[model samples]
Target chain A: MSKRSDPRLIERVLRGEHAAASRALSLVIDEAPEADALSKAFFPKSGSAQKIGVCGPPGAGKSSLTSRLVAHYRKQKLKIGILAVDPSSPISGGAFLGDRLRIQEHAMDPGVFIRSLANRGMIGGVSYTIFGAMHVLEAWGCDKIIVETVGTGQDEVEIGKVADTIVYVTTPSMGDEIQAMKAGVMEIGDIFVVNKSDLHGSDKALSDLRSAMSLGRTHEAKPWEPPVLGTSALTGKGVDELGKALDDHWTHLKKSEEGRRRLREQHKEELSLYISRRVYRSALDKISDRNLDDLVEHKIDPASLGTKILKK
Target chain B: MESKPFRVLIAKPGLDGHDRGAKVIVRALRDAGFEVIYTGIRQTPEMIAQTALQEDVDAVGLSLLSGAHMTLFPQITKLLKDRGLKDVLVFGGGIIPDEDVAKLKKKGIDQVFGPGTPLTTIVDYLNSRLPSVKKK
Candidate 1:
């Protein structure tokens, strides 16, 4: 836990050495003491790579679409990094990460670097180490970084805070139109994709998504309108369009005031995230078994105990 | 000091279709509190090593039932080493002959578990060997 990151290793990582990058990623994943140094060396080198988040329900072909997107980007000679998140079992604290199985074609490609992550009890579809991982990838010179979140439900909109763009995937007959009209995660999508378009009723799903977007309240004074695109990852259809849409968003973000605002927001979010992590760690460490028992037994009230712990 | 969960990669490295045994091991390893990345079936040595490098797993578990263990297991280990992963523990399971198991150990495979080996034995072996959990 007190490992020191070699400056030579950090240099190798900046030189685009995959092995060194992977090792740095391990340090970040473990939250080892050395990771703070790695982050300090890598943070300025980040923001060059486009961070894209892919989220959807289970069985929605999120992995397959991510694979296609990688292929699409690779065709243009872009270096790609992927972080695929899967849920950890509450009972065993273990996870079966299978997202790489769908994207195995790129396993041998030197231009592609993929890492699997367990949620580690963090909610909102991603692990807490994700930001640090992104820093490593960006420092390693990846032009595009794709973060595939754990299969998300209606409430896991945390991807919006982490990525520059969010692609929300859905399948045909997944839900009623009213479900699309609802608020939470539905409102955070920069691009809404109805994947598995090869299936029947895909047109209906597309129209429903389009109508829902139009009927919902708009982002006042926003320059870019979110597009609802249909894609079939099996046949690789409409994937080209999705790529173009993503590129357009990237360009818009560069040239628009809204984009600059988002970048500022992301930095703010990063600072707050670090503060909250330290606060929680120290606050939780302060709690004792007796204090917990008193709270459970209703002896010490919630407000007073919270104030006492925070004050300490 | 805080330690992360040990990550293990479970892969089938040949044209083997018998995967019930492999799935059982995967489940057992998961239950024993190790994060396992399972590449469904029919993987090449390059794929397995590449995956191990990207995932930064502490150990690699190769399961083969096609009797090609002799040809594939060593190649997988060599590829892992070629990728600068010399410290990763490589283990195999299948119908490997006793003599071949000895040869594999020399070629850098740490251990070989045959059919009918108890799940706890595999789990305990890994827990003891993984660098993530240093033996105290």
Candidate 2:
């Protein structure tokens, strides 16, 4: 384990060797004992990459739009890292990660590194592995890291905690303007894009999104106003504009106090995620089957057993 | 912490547009607790190899129905080898003669599954041959 986290491997990762980066990411995903050391080694080299989160409801063309964004960023010679998250089956604890299908054109590009991750039972459109994976990509010298979340519903706003900028995508005919009015994910967007603008009622979706943005909540004015744009990831329509919007948002973040606050919040979230995972695993490991059976058979209560496990 | 699941890349090479069988394998593998990355149809050898490298899959499953498996399978394995992914288990499935199975294996394909082969057999094969239960 110590040898795996050796300085030579760290050096290769810093040099952006594909094999090293992949190996480092696997260590993190597997939660190997050396992952802590690797994370510490990579932490200082990270934070330079622009982290963008693409999220929306299922079938909203999140993957397609993410591929378009990768292309847009690559045009400027920026090395990009893509982490596409897919759902894991609760029944089998496995996943079918197919997001790479849309981005296959970039499969052979040296400037781009794309990996598909199973959500691994995380409910907020991403897995706990994501934070570590992002650090690995950042350490690998990716100028931009785009995380495409598993299709999220209204409340899966965890991306807002992880990404520097969130691009919320949606398609037409999803619902009425009221759908956008109801708060949850709609509020987290730094940029709202109505993808598949070529489809019917795209204009209406665009208008609805715009109207929703204008009806901001009671909070004081934010320096950055979320822009609502229409785009077609298929024909490359409005993608360039979306790219510029992302860049502008990054610039805005760098200059604003909100950006620093977001950085602090991101670190806090990372720490909490790590602690939660550790606690969950340890608690489960400490639970005895007798206690589990007792709880299941109503011989003991859950709260008492939960407290007992924590004490243990 | 959650145990890392074995990741596999299931790709279709050559001009075979039908992915029904590949999709079935994908689902079966997923149900059997493997993370399966399915690159749709008509994937070139280069694309498959690149995806496997980036995904860092423990295995690459090539499904070819276009009868070009003889050429494409070796190309993919060679590409994977050249890219420092020789450790990745390379497997194939399609309509191939029994004689070609040994030939494919000699060229770096680890295993071949024919049509109507039981899904559990495929699952068990992966479970047994995957490099380690712990790490990729």
Off by over 4 Å in 1: A1-4, A217-222, A288-306, B131-136
Q: Model 2 over residues A44-101: C-alpha lDDT tens digits? A: 9767998999999989999999888888888899999999999999999989998989
The 10-residue segment with the lowest total lDDT in model 1 chain A: A1-10
Best by DockQ: 2
Give the CA lDDT, 0 to 100, for residue A76 in model 2. 96
DockQ of predicted model 2: 0.68
| Deviation of model 1 at B63, angstroms | 0.3
Q: Residue A26 in model 1: shift from native, Å?
A: 1.1
Q: After aligning candidate 1 to the native by TM-score, how far in Å is the CA of B45 from where it should be? A: 1.0
Calculate DockQ per candidate and list them: 0.61, 0.68
lDDT of each: 0.89, 0.89
For residues A1-312, write the lDDT of model 1, one tens digit per residue: 333346698999999988898989999888877888998999998789889999999889999999999999999999999999999888888888889889988998999999999998889999888899999999999999999999999999888888989999999978768999988889889999999999999999999889888885566855778999999999999999999999999998888886778778777877787788778878888889999899999999989998999999
